[model samples]
Target: MPLFGRKKSEDPSALRWSREPLPPTPEPGPDGLRSMEDHRDYLLSCLTELPPFSQHLLDALDLSICEDVYSAIDMPRFDNSAMDGYAVRAVDVAAASAEHPVSLPVVGEVAAGQDALDRLSPGTAIKIMTGAPLPPAADAIVPYENTDRGASDVRVFAPSVVSQHVRYVGEDIRAGSQLFAAGAQLGPRDVGLLAAIGRDTVLVRPRPRVAVVSTGSELVEPGQELGHAHQIYDSNSTMLAAAAKAAGAQVYRVGLVSDDPESVLQVISDQLVRADLILSTGGVSQGDYDVVKAVLPQLGETDFTAVAMQPGKPQGFGLIGDDRVPMIMLPGNPVSAFVSFEAFVRPAIRKLMGVTPYTRPVVRCRATHDFGSAPGKRQLARGIVSLDADGGRLVELAGGHGSHLLGDLARANAIIVLGEDVTQVATGDDVDVWLLDEVS
Candidate 1:
């Protein structure tokens, strides 16, 4: 019952998804065609607020904080030595020099995680290891290199500066101060900080649950024998599922569905309870066997449209079911699905989890090859962006501009965004490229 309500159409012709005379494409928006940014905004508008955070351990990476987190105690917690050295009084080592060395009795030895209960007597020193607590009454640290590096007794050959190599309490962060602001997505460094402050768990936004399904009768699973003529392997669902996971969403791959309209409806109905977002590939296109197009409209509120982008033009999105989960329909081509996920779905996933700066970092680089673009359509062409010998950033095309070019998608590390007004990019032209992966 949670997946059944939808405003029924009075006319029977409005429900058809047959290839006979495919539904008329919506008129292009005023800016020539629906710009990539416009389509993204529309998708975001339909997606409602995600649930708040639950307590998550520090080891859970890529989770965003739901509220500000303040430390209960100061960072470092106590004064400690920054290096292996001799803790001594500043005055005792003041006149010591390499030519005329001063010797002091080693009163104690302090190692990390051990308390230093012994106070330094005048003219004596304590041998300290790195991260060891400084002895009481010791105001300076003389490095081993400046001394004889002895355990019984140490020699001071240089004047030690006051508080040298000493990490004071509250130096990094003060007690009760805000450690991380609300909406902060924890990284490795952040995890270290939280662990250093003795936090076992912190409140974090729940990762969005995504259900991915591929719809096409011509699809076959990889590793299986493809005896049927022209049967393509089901790569779209796998690619989208991985992309969703990489974007910090929990993914449930529903596998490949045939062109049976009734079965497509059933699969979507079953997945409604588990999915915050539903993603389907193949069946939204203008084809006779596009079962998702035929079946989705009856299930809930949805839309099928053409976006003015190369490769991933045919787009579908809308809210559906009692929970109003957002569903995005993508093209079956491997390259198109990948590009659309990077440009659109990735940002949506990040936004839902309250991640700041959700979009991939963009940089302007000198084009090393000419790239042709479609007229009146924005193009996201795959490219290899890297730095040259002279430290200048350069970008070159990765593969041919075809939606089915899976090899190109695999080799691409960046996307060269070409605007509708631009037709071609010549060598040495500055083009904006969105980084696809981490680059040194």
Candidate 2:
């Protein structure tokens, strides 16, 4: 099956998404310590791709089409001139060249989009502009560079062949022909082509609405002055909101909520009207102040699982409110939250939007330094990946592997993955890298 479109029942692993989601993935081991793939797949299985809608061309950027499209009219519409010169019978210019130029009276003029003038007689010519309808009985054109351009009369300096510089009807696209198959994603060029084929709107999956919230009594807005040394500004909501936006989601960044269970539950409940997906940062760990993990149980069927991954092991997933809007609870620490988003949330958002291959591109590269990993957990280390002198990819760890190091996460352009059971890796060893940003 093609790896990338529709009818919600289809599988994205083989192709693209639809309005409904794929089947439930297998559960984790008896201990409930989920692997990265199991956690991600479970979240994906809980979602339904946003339903299709008839959206105008200007508003449908980056959306996948829900159905095939057929053109109603021919692309050229008629035989037209492809050059600004003269249109005449090919036989008329066959013997004409620079040395023996043929002079003919210019009976009329036709600019682009204008109706053709009277039919051409045996040896006469019709001056025409690029895209102008070819005159009746005229089968060829001589470019302005190949002739002495004239208004009343024209001189052909070179021979012209039949159909030269002429755009025939339906040459580019035929009427009633298939223009796009079901599940084609729209880019700028695709939009232009749809417009050229006379489409005002197309049925496609809508961008998912995602709500991002951060919870903690110690967390304050970025601009606020801190009252105590222990207090810290919340950055997870901002980062995750921006990330969701970049992934083509409609984001509602509910910046900060107190750690109280009632407040957390109320805020999350209010978001269900607009959110298709929800992301809450902090309060999933075993700490006494972890209210999100505590309050979410009252909202819907919520699960707090220890995912076997470094920096982001504590994870929570829930179907909140009566609508069952899916929610993911991330680690409060900056790096862990970001890494969890890359592994789980980004694909979920893309799947909801029905986009293909809803995951970051992974490439194999050599590590520039040595690193160690937990014996039974996956590690996503921040790193800077670059091309070597010979164009081979090489990566060096950006900052020490600390979950709280936000500065290093900002500097890195890729995630260096260390799988479970990989106790240590030596310098120059091959590693799989997930590209996070464009490499120049």
Cα error, residue 22 of model 1, in Å, equals: 23
lDDT of 2 by residue, 1-440 (tens): 11112122122122221223324445766555789988888888887788788999978888889989999999899999988889899898898888899888888889987888888998988889999999999999989998888878888889989989999999999999998886778999999999998888999888888899999999989888998999998889999999999888889999899998778877887776678898999999999999999877766777788988887999988876555678999999999999999999999988988887878878998988887877788889998998988988999999898999999999999998888879998999999899998776
Over 4 Å off, model 2: 1-32
RMSD of 1: 5.3
lDDT of 2: 0.85
TM-score of 1: 0.90
Q: Model-by-model lDDT, in order?
A: 0.81, 0.85
Q: State the lDDT of candidate 1 residue by residue for 1-440, as single tens digits.
A: 12234433343223332222222334567754677877877777665546564555653578887778888898778888888899999999999999999999998899999998588899999999988988899988998889998778888899988998899989989999998888778898888888888887887767888899998888899899997688988888988999899889989999988888777877777677678788888877888887777778766677777788987988887565555567888888889888888877888888777786868877999999777788788899999888889888899999899999998889999998888889988989999899887654
Off by over 4 Å in 1: 1-27, 30-33
Query: Of the candidates shown, which would achieve the greatest lDDT relative to the real structure?
Result: 2
Write down the worst ten-residue block by lDDT for model 2: 1-10
